[model samples]
Target: MIIELKSLDEIDPCEFAYYANDPNINTYLRNSFPAPYTLDHALSFITHSLQHHALDFAIVVDGKCVGCVGVTFQKDIFLKNAEIGYWLNSQYWGKGIMSQVIKMLCSYLFSNYTIHKICADVFAENKASCIVLEKNGFIQEGYRREHIYKDGCYHDLILYALWRNSDEY
Candidate 1:
């Protein structure tokens, strides 16, 4: 599978909106992404992504987008770190595709950007995500209780990180 960084215009916003709108897909995501997501929301998100200095890409497989992954750089004391975010279509779950994409992105970021640490947050109930992080050598840093209120209840968030100079597992 080949991974490439793409601009918003390079992707189909409608397809992305449909994937995000799926209830099962948004269940573990942050509150900023509303359920029943629409094309307008996706358009807005694309606009924001383009404006920001973040590295965002549509995860393409066999020339079709199955998901997206991005690195959002934080300011101030977190300047040397980037928060990674990603999502895949439910149909592609358990296929190890995301693991490959994430590993590729992490390597690319370390080489191309000034980021020293890559961080990610997984919902406490999402064991699959936790496994993925572990498989990629991301160490569990901490857990924040009731950090995010999603799907009508507060959810704990597990923080994980991988350093650029760490040994590859």
Candidate 2:
């Protein structure tokens, strides 16, 4: 399968809405990603993407927005680091798409920015994500026990990071 990461403007709002609304997909992500994701939310996201000059991208598969990925660069003393985020359609699960997407994004971020680290904090229950990050050369830096409270309970957060000058990067 061919997967291309494109800027937000290059993606269709309708297609974006179609993919962003998945409950399973939203389960592991932050609460900001609404469960009943609507056209309005997609439009709002598009607007933010346009205005923020965000590192975000729409994961395009054959011209359709099947997933999304991005990074948030830190400020001040942490300017050399960024946090990575991503999600794929449930229908595309177990297809090895996200690993490649993560690799591609990491490569771009390391190449284009002066970032020294790219990281992600995955819910401890998410075994697949932890494995994927490990496969991509992200080391387990720390574990925050019960670092988050969501979906009506507490959840641990696993911190994973990749260094810019490392062989992995």
Candidate 3:
């Protein structure tokens, strides 16, 4: 399937919200994504993402948005690095769409941004996400025990990172 990453305006927010708000889709995500997500939440997210100049995009496949991904820069000691986050509609999982979109986005970040490293955190139970990161060349840095609380339980997180080097980028 063809993949395209575009600005939030290029997508229909209602359609995106419908897929994203599904409990099945949000299960693996952070607690910030509320259950029974509303249009207001989607609008707020779109507005915030735009205003923050976040490198966010609607992951489109065959002309329909199937997911979302973004890279957020960190300042201070992490000034040279950026954190990556992504989520796909449950219906589209296992289709390799996210992998393709992530690879393209990572290439764009390395080529365009001043950042030297890209990092991500995945809940330890999210094995599929870890696989995607590994397949894209991110090294498993370490695991954070009970780092986040979600759904009434503490979850361990696995940190993964990839550095920009002439041979890799």
Instruction: Judging by TM-score against the true structure, name the best candidate.
Output: 2
C-alpha RMSD for every candidate: 1.8, 0.9, 1.3
Q: Pick the candidate with the highest lDDT.
A: 2
- What is each predicted model's overall lDDT from 0 to 1? 0.83, 0.89, 0.86
TM-score for each prediction?
0.90, 0.97, 0.95
lDDT of 1 by residue, 78-150 (tens): 8999999888888778878888888888888888888889999999999988998888999999999999886
Q: Per-residue lDDT for 5-38 in model 2, tens only?
A: 9999988899899998888897778889888999
TM-score of 3: 0.95
The alpha-carbon lDDT assigned to residue 84 of candidate 2 equals 91
Kindly report which residue stretches of model 2 are placed more than 4 angstroms away from their true locations once superposed. none
75: Cα error in model 3, Å: 0.3
- Candidates 1 and 2 compared by lDDT, better number: 2
